[model samples]
Target: MTTSRLEDLDEANLSPAQKVIYDQILSGPRGIVEGPLRVWLKSPKLADKAQALGAFCRYDTNLPPRLSELAIITTGAVWRAGFEWAVHAPIAIKAGVSPQIAEAIRLGQEPQFEAEDEAAVYAFSRELHENRGVSDATYQRCVAALGEEVTVELVGILGYYTFISMTINAFHVPLPAGASDPFPAK
Candidate 1:
């Protein structure tokens, strides 16, 4: 079994600054202080700044949850961020991404998409993650299918989750109890 490099914080032992940040996270849309937030809370100032950006990217972005979650899971797959995939896969599905699509991403394979926008999103995300940037053709496909504004939001979602994935991987964050690693040994 894998163990986290950083120990989880105890709520009762939280410093005042940590408590404040924890409270804000609790009152926010997420209503829970888990995942990378647990790790980020070690540096409260950094947690404050990063969580603010994360809140906007996650809750306030113009990209619909379907597209936003799609970008997130794709980022998770690219990073092999097991914690990220565990958290967001169900959310992606509840927001309309197919189980087949989520599974394909977990396995690093191309999914057969029925919607034009879904196809465009997967392509753009895959290209951005694998190539480090989208080519003109892929960018144009995204903008055409999702419009400039939503496409921009998609980028923000991808970028934010990239940061989250980095945190999860670097900190050796373990999967939640009873949750399997989304990417198992092949």
Candidate 2:
């Protein structure tokens, strides 16, 4: 890790409110899972929205894992939500985002693919991330390739990740050290 990133992880400087909740969650049962959600639950509005969004991510039928992860990591890159990128990039990889592809995502680079379907995911996700909305051309291509249900799920997946990005950025969850960090250094 860079000295600068190490400086960022120095927990000694955590805000007082953050420190309090961090300790409570870290001491709770299943701290690893609870920690992130606990931080997001600060606002009732956000918590309810996150719960519904999370269910959609987990249970949505039409979105295959690869495409879902594409939308997720793309939002992570756009938001530069260090912790969001730090967490889900590996899940994307596990769901079949190639190391090369995952690295490209981390560095804000475009994915390379020969298949039109793959290109649609790459293009659609990139467009959604870069523009805060999908381009009509990209949308049409995605719909033609993957159909409307999947296209909607893809957009919803992006919305979910965008929500996560905002929450993680606001409270500043430091990525875990020494584990497989999702957004590995460029």
Best by TM-score: 1
Superpose all Cα atoms of candidate 1 onto the true structure and report the RMSD in Å to 1 decimal.
1.1
Q: lDDT by residue for model 2 over 95-130, one digit each (tens)? A: 877878778877877777666776798799778777
lDDT tens per residue, model 1, 1-186: 267899899999999999999999999999989989999999999999999999999999887899889889999999999999999999999999999999999988889999999899999999998998999999999999999998888988888899999999999888877899887766
Highest lDDT among the candidates is held by which one? Answer: 1
Residue 80, model 2: Cα distance from true site in angstroms: 1.6
Candidate 1 global TM-score: 0.96
Quote the lDDT for 80 in model 2: 74
Q: What value does the lDDT take at residue 136 in candidate 2?
A: 83
Model-by-model lDDT, in order? 0.92, 0.68
Which residue pairs clash within candidate 2? none
